[model samples]
Target chain A: AQSVTQLDSHVSVSEGTPVLLRCNYSSSYSPSLFWYVQHPNKGLQLLLKYTSAATLVKGINGFEAEFKKSETSFHLTKPSAHMSDAAEYFCVVSDRVLTGGGNKLTFGTGTQLKVEL
Target chain B: GAGVSQTPSNKVTEKGKYVELRCDPISGHTALYWYRQSLGQGPEFLIYFQGTGAADDSGLPNDRFFAVRPEGSVSTLKIQRTERGDSAVYLCASTPGGSRTQYTDTQYFGPGTRLTVL
Candidate 1:
């Protein structure tokens, strides 16, 4: 079984400041993590993913995340927050199924980021 | 290339009625998935299809929920006896298949269909 927990339900940050969204996951097998963002009335977009390659994964839109096995965390971070960054972000996890041979994503409750100008 | 697309961005149905949501995955994507997101909650997996067969359906909530990928490219989620509790955002995603390490492949998602049961 696998699951994800996003520590913060809501976070507010001013423009040009650092942004942080915390996420923790649990899995029986090797886990693959991802961060997805959804704008108002828009589709969910992939921000980044960690697939056991590099601990530090870089993604589009100046966002990145670090996978810490010891901590069981994959927190998203950005050096500077943009006005357009305000959205709902979800942290997801996937593991190889033993019988199905497919990957099913387990998502976190999500964190709503509010960027202030 | 075209991304995943879902038909009827918004759907409204009366209680006990039946509804079908359609999903068209990206060209050449062999794997398709269905998920549901309730208000203020994350998306929960419903089912997965590899080619024309259902690879995993363990996430389906009940017998009322069913999905199929007859052509292996287009998929549909059918709900029978829809209830108020069943109203939520139904999301569809797809990933490129044939990867030796399938877990590493990224899944592209669609805008989702908002089902409102009244």
Candidate 2:
């Protein structure tokens, strides 16, 4: 019974400004968390993932997220927002380890980031 | 080094009709997955295949949804009696190995096939 909840359905930010997309999760055991970005008409691209090794995970395009166990959160952040950064972002959790779901991914509803220039 | 690919980028059919969506995983990938994504929603898991066998199909919504990875490389997701509710983007993903390996944690996604049931 692992799930992810993205706090915001849509977020708008000015170019070069800081950006933040919040996500929370509920899992019974240690969980694997991931961030994926999807551009229009394109496939999902892996942004970053948090395993047991790292709490502050850095991803491509200068994006990063911090895995907070106590807060039950994994929030994605970026220092500067570029036009290319505007896309749909998903917070995902793995279900294989605990639920025997064979590496299935449970995704949040997703947050659409709009970068305003 | 092509990424995972899916056929018929878009499909339109009438309700009660059947449809088949295909996926071609990355060359060396041993695990394939199927997911359905509705508008403005995250993709929902449908099934997982490991080397030609479906290791997990519990996520399938109903018996009308079925999938098969015949040769461990290609997979076909068959939907029977399609309904308007089934209209959504069907995404396919693949990973290099099974859950036993660390690399398997990352699932590469395809562009997805948008299905519209009229």
TM-score leader: 1
Tens-place lDDT digits, model 2, residues B31-104: 88899999888999898887888888888999999999888999999999999999999999988775564333
Cα error, residue B31 of model 1, in Å, equals: 0.3
lDDT by residue for model 1 over B24-68, one digit each (tens)?
Answer: 999999989999999999998889898999889988999999999
In order, what DockQ does each candidate have?
A: 0.70, 0.56
lDDT value, candidate 2, whole model: 0.90
Q: Which regions of candidate 2 fall more than 4 Å away from where they truly are? A: A98-101, B102-104
Off by over 4 Å in 1: none
- Candidate 1 vs. truth: CA RMSD? 1.0
**Residues A1-117, model 1: lDDT tens digits:** 899999999999999999999999999889999999999778889999998899999999999999999999999999999999999999999985523466788999999999998
- Residue pairs with backbone atoms closer than 3 Å in model 1 (clashes): none
Question: What's model 2's lDDT at A97?
Answer: 43
